[model samples]
Target: MTNYLIDNAGVLIGPVEFPVVPGLGVEIPSNAVRLTQPLEHAKPGHVWVMVDGLPEERVDYRGVVYRTDNGKSLLWREVAELPNTVTAKAWPGTHYYWTGDDWELDQSALAAEKKAQVLLERDTLMQHAQLRIAPLHYAEQLQLITQDEQTALLGWMRYCVELNRLEQSPEFPMNMEWPVPPTVGTP
Candidate 1:
């Protein structure tokens, strides 16, 4: 189990002191509050502590922090519509910080968004891989070659590594067949 504490600057608007216990996972409701700012300076791996007992509007409200081994990280981007799960995009090295209240994005919230673009790039890279030469083709298939592409790929690779180091996974097999040597084209 992971342990975390509520940030000192993250007190609620009212005078009530939020209770935080060690080894507890904070639950943020789907509708009440959204994380608005990037809690970049907060401690690493500390869970967001939620308040208990409120109206139904406040029921099921919670949030938490997630840190990856990579240097890049961000806050829990969640919505009340999803009920209990908060979605976050983290890179290779990062830690979590709990910002008071739930956060919502405006037109200017591109600073921490990565998932959609990354997914699209990965798809594009894979499509490009299908037409390239072997081995070199396979390496390209699994990687993003451009600088920006590489940054995005590294984020995804880090996430996968944290979940289940694919390099060591037995189910992940490598293709050793070389592509047929190109014959003289009669073009």
Candidate 2:
């Protein structure tokens, strides 16, 4: 059986159970935590680290310090979240914090305030004039135009095309402009 202590820095001091092979019967190195066992329902002082939901080997959860050995080095890491602390998965959820009195949801009263701000912004955009759509009527008359008419209409868009390099050999613009694009969706 693996030996554990009930004292020290909650470091679990025990050898992992390894199966005995026919020819390989050598002992392997391991990590152990010396905890104040008699295993009470007390919070671990500083043994485990609770970073994510994924189980961590070298973390002290409650009163147990988990340890892991990856054949190379034994790791005894502490999770980011300490015991007796309230936490949440992400934003827009009921975030909890450890209050002196008890575990409280949103120690700061900013959850509803921030959510209201987002709703206000959304409503403002929906009521803006730019958001209203109008029925666009294409020209009913078939206007006869030369080949150059269509190209002239699209001249504003040609600022993006790379010039003075291709075999097509298009003439350069009246003046050189930076190759920057429109920050917004519209060109």
Candidate 3:
């Protein structure tokens, strides 16, 4: 059974999903506008300062003064083209490298860069945490245990077995064998 109405000529009819008529979406038009479809690159004649590397290493002499990454009041201005009194007062942390032009994205890429740095630091910390290993020994056979060494050798064997069983990966097994070299004992 047909759910949609059709004309006598047998063409399905429906309300238009997109009709063309627009005033403006915002109460006041903003200089900074987000594209409905983002552009691959900044518009022509636009001055864009791309900040990716360490700030200390980057040399930007454009009029745009950037906020230092250290989170202090010490703003970084171009030594050659320092901001005048009025421009310096208005310069914000949001400034990266500025094109003398006014239009820019409301948010910069700085936050994502900072987050990546934090994750790297956390990974370094985890690698420094030591995994404890209990003392152990290697023996050729059960008969090798002497009167005084019997108890010690038995304890070491049990420790190795329990450690391997607890930590071994079923899919990709590790060499859970003791890492140290065994020396010949004095009989």
Clashing residue pairs in all predictions, respectively, total 20, 19, 0
Best candidate according to lDDT: 1
Give the Å shift of residue 49 in candidate 3: 36
For every model shown, what is its TM-score relative to the native structure?
0.16, 0.23, 0.20
Off by over 4 Å in 1: 1-113, 133-187
In model 3, what are the clashing residue pairs, if there are any?
Answer: none
After superposition, which runs of candidate 2 have C-alpha atoms over 4 Å from their true positions?
1-94, 100-102, 107-111, 126-187
Q: Superposing every Cα of model 2 onto the true structure, what RMSD results?
A: 18.8
Model 3: per-residue Cα lDDT over 1-187, one tens digit each = 1122223322222321232347743332221222233223333323223223111112234343333232124444342334432233233445253345332433436545544554454344333211111121223253554544555545444444443343343421222232221122212
Model 2 quality (TM-score): 0.23
For model 3 the local lDDT of residue 56 reads 15
Candidate 3: list runs displaced more than 4 Å: 1-90, 94-108, 130-187
- What is the lDDT of every predicted structure here? 0.34, 0.33, 0.33
lDDT of 3: 0.33
